[model samples]
Target: MPRRYLFYVEQNYCYGILRPIQNVLRSRGDEVAWLPVGDAFDRGGFEAGERVFDHVREAIAWSPCAVMVPGNFVPGFIPGIKVMVTHGLISEKRRKKDGVIYSFIERGLFDLYITHGPNTTTRWRQMADEAGYFEVAECGWPKLDPLFDGSLRRNASAGPVIYFASTFSPRLAAAPRLFDTVARLVAERDWQWRIQFHPKMPAAVTDRYRALSGDRLRVVDGHDTLQLLLDADVMLCDTSSIISEFALLQKPVVTYRNLSPRPYMIDVREPSAVGPALARALQRPPEVMRAVAEHARETHPWTDGRSSERVIEATDRLVESGLGHLRPKPRNRIRHWKMRRALRYYRLFPTR
Candidate 1:
């Protein structure tokens, strides 16, 4: 019989990863179930969780050898093999809450933690080790598979439009200066500026920007951002993993950092004050843009877009091991005590 599997979605947007994985697995005749952990009711349907843990436990009880959850879902009670796939390369400071929750969950609960990219895996391994997680893997992020297709990235003769993948944190919105800078840029740019807001952003702010932008600024809803990225000339962002995706496209990206009232438990970099200066540089020659583009390409290296394949292979290995009940040998008592003490010590630190 095909192996049963449970896939947990932290939010609706996670369909980016979930859809592709589901497609690949279902094609192989595996039985897969999708669990939405976020507020799905507003979007359309509701997930009825009888007990808080029922959602996870029932998925486990179905005899699934492997359960894949996002970083947010805690599978502490699931008495089976578990793996977590992270979308963001969050720093410990930004993900303190997740770290704390993982501390509780990683104590012999999860067998593997899969990161979005190999570089992200390198960045997060230290923290995972510190948190008592040892079975970490650099399975590439499965979300960028669509971009690898040749037809998806053909540039228009008119040149591609600039896409702003906005993540409006309450704190960041409070910064009037950033808004003013963006408004000024929108007013000046002859090309189209498409703004894609996070679903959680307040409608009022969006309406206000919409009014200010007129025809040049467009706000989109329920659109596939991957398609937008494929057609975009440049991507303007602030500390989102979208930056990494843009890098894969080998396009120009300008990241803004100096915003206030940041998002809860998320780390963002400040955009260089030379943003306006960079705009001037953009006008002068392609040289400046070329330099920045090169840096982005170098910084992020999963451009072959084979991350999904890596993720699938890692998942298959876990499924095989879990089906066979082949976990690591039990630790000696003294080592177990030491690990317990380490968990307690990390708990003492502030959590997001």
Candidate 2:
């Protein structure tokens, strides 16, 4: 029997994470559609022939069997088994006080949490056992299927290409502090610089970087972030989860004051140090490259590009087995009320 699935998106970058899975779903004659939750998502990013319902009510009417979410939360009222396909791999983005990573937090909004690697699987399995309301399964992230399948190409550029990215958070973001340094480097080096910021990055900061766009430096909207990860020779980033993606490609990454600096990254302290760190990254030191390989092993062991297939299989099996073992999810009345008000969806028994 064919299954209907909904890809619930709330951010510009979530498209990359969900699209590959859509391809798998369609190839198997299953139905899939996207639902851009709010204004935060860019409608322009939607491709031709992709089905999207403008309202949450219509999505409820569609009767999807599964809802794949890349962002934090989705209305529990929506039909189907809610699956959390996280937006990014783990990185240094963490709480300043206790060094707790945000991605590990369970929002109680999902029935299934897809694990990209063993570390995540172990942690979430423990959480699942404790919560008794969700399930954790290991199936590599679908976003990198193209990357590992040997489909993406390293775009031809005259000099080494450097991808510069930053988290949107004011405290963790490196763009604000390194803007002048980046400008000077763009002026000095022939190195091709590609800047892609988190979707929520303030316009003032993005605008300054966009102004630097020209022959050598261009600001990418990050819809094609995975492509940038494939093409760039070195990644210059700060605390953003993108660091893990770039490093998974076995490329050198230059991180600025990363909370947890790993052997794979060239961690720098100041703006003045970015250039030298980038230089070192470009060199691709044997030790760092070796660490990069090991990092890939630990993060996502599957390079077969069949993670999408695995994810679908796991989801189907779970559905067939039923949710009998797991306990009921908490009502979360307050959160559900907030979601209903925000989306203006007051329908109680949403068109079963």
Candidate 3:
């Protein structure tokens, strides 16, 4: 019998993160479905033939064997081995009402942590020891698999393409700060420009970029950012995780006052210096290229496009071991209440 699985897309970026894994699942003759969790996500991100549930009842009745999440939380009432694949591999901090939280922090919502690389694997392994209920495996990120698989690449552009993406956080966003500089650079250089902002980016900022779009330049607001990264010769970003993703492609990235400028990145504090920094990155100097290689090795050493397969393997191994040995997860009353309220599932007991 074909096993069933669910891809829990809490955010639009989750589409990119989980699609590769979904491919592996379907290839193995396993069934997969989607449960999108928020209104913030764009429905256009879904492609035809991809099965999506309209509500929590649809998911519950299907009773998938596993649920892969790219975001932090999942409804425990959903039947599955809750797998946390995480949203991004960046070391950025997210500020919450309580305090600053890193991605590794446990939210008592998952049974497995599919880590991207050695750095994340090590941290998640340590966390697993304390958590007791979850297991951690260092299966490289599935999201980057398409970049390796040659299935996602676009045709080479007529001109050198520069891809620009920015975070939405006011304190860290460069879109607002470098808008004029980017506009000027676009005018000065004949190079093609592709700009994409974080989904949370203000409409005002996006409107400004949209107004500037033309034949050679575009403000990409869809879910095909991986395609944009492949098309670009160099990436221009703020402190967004796209910087890390682009660098992993063994390309150069120029940032505006990056919070932690890696050697692989050409960082500039002043918007005026943006042009020169971009010029340097475009040159692909030996040092910058070497640093980009090193950064990729440290973060995600798998460029072979087999991470999705490995994720499947890891899940199979965990299932073989069974869940009886693991400790029980906490009740998490308030969190479960919120999920039930939003997803509207209030069954007294989990069916699976």
Candidate 4:
């Protein structure tokens, strides 16, 4: 029998991580089903619900393994082998205002935490240890598909681009500050810049960027970020895993997390210590291209772009082992309650 998966996807936002994994899983003969938390969140008009928790519980009961994308409503009651493949392994340097809802997940509910690099695993392990549970692994970043192959290409327009691939967080104030500076710096230049904001970010910020609309300063929404990075001449970001993709392209990438903690992440080969060393790289990025190249190799020792293969291998191993005991369920039932609900939906909404 083929392997079955009940994957939880929080729509729009987790496309980068979930989409690639879905393709790989299906290609490997796994029957995959999606429970879109994004759709659920929207349906509730952004309000929280027990339905979200109930859906996750159902998915876990049906499949031996369930991948829960972070930022969705996590299952508080289910204590199965909840595996977390982080959307992007980011540093705590730039804290979001909403103290990571899932931070407390370390409390004995999860079994494995897959991370892109050792640095991230180390940090999370400490957090998990503090929470009294410790099981973390470095499986590399599976979503960085473009980096593994030279499949992505630059845009047809051939216009110079400044890609803004970051979500606005108050902790990393340097990011917005640098963005404004770059906007002012490039406002007069002949080149064009595109700003891509995080989905949850308020429209007001995007509107502020739009006001600076010189032919060069353009505010855009919903562009394929991977394609944008591939096409752009230079990328300016802060502590976002997008840099890992940029490293694979071997492009000129400058980071703006100067005020944040020494960002320990995957593919950040070079030490981003402050003063002349960091400033010079930002000012003249091409000059440090060689250093970035050398450091990327050291930082991502296994990052030859075969993350998808590794993930595939890991899943295959799980299947072979008959899936470590299914995510826990209420003892009285054979089939999970959510599966029953989903069947009802299929029967009623069959054509629609």
Candidate lDDT values, in order = 0.55, 0.87, 0.85, 0.52
Off by over 4 Å in 2: 95-99, 349-352
lDDT of 4 by residue, 121-149 (tens): 56677865654433455667666676456
Candidate 3 C-alpha lDDT tens digits along 1-352: 8999898887788888888888888887999999887888777778899999989899989999888888888888888789888688856565666554476678888888888878678877888897898899888888889899878757677788999988899989999998898889778888899988887899999999898898678988776678888889999988877788888988999988888788999999999999998888889999999999988887899989999998888887777687788888878888888889888777774432
Q: Which whole-number lDDT from 0 to 100 does residue 308 have in model 3?
A: 90
Q: Which whole-number lDDT from 0 to 100 does residue 3 have in model 1? A: 69
Candidate 1 segments whose C-alpha is farther than 4 A from its true place: 40-58, 89-109, 123-133, 150-160, 173-177, 212-214, 258-300, 323-352
TM-score for each predicted model, relative to the true structure: 0.70, 0.94, 0.94, 0.67
lDDT of 1 by residue, 41-105 (tens): 13342334311222533554675666676654444333445677665543222434553422123
Clashing pairs in 2: none
Cα displacement (angstroms), candidate 4, residue 197, comes to: 1.2
Kindly give the stretch of ten consecutive residues in candidate 3 with the minimal lDDT sum. Answer: 92-101
Off by over 4 Å in 3: 94-101, 349-352
Q: What are the RMSD figures for all models against the true structure?
A: 8.3, 2.2, 2.0, 8.5
Looking at candidate 4, the ten consecutive residues that score lowest on lDDT are 343-352
The better-scoring model by lDDT among 1 and 2 is 2
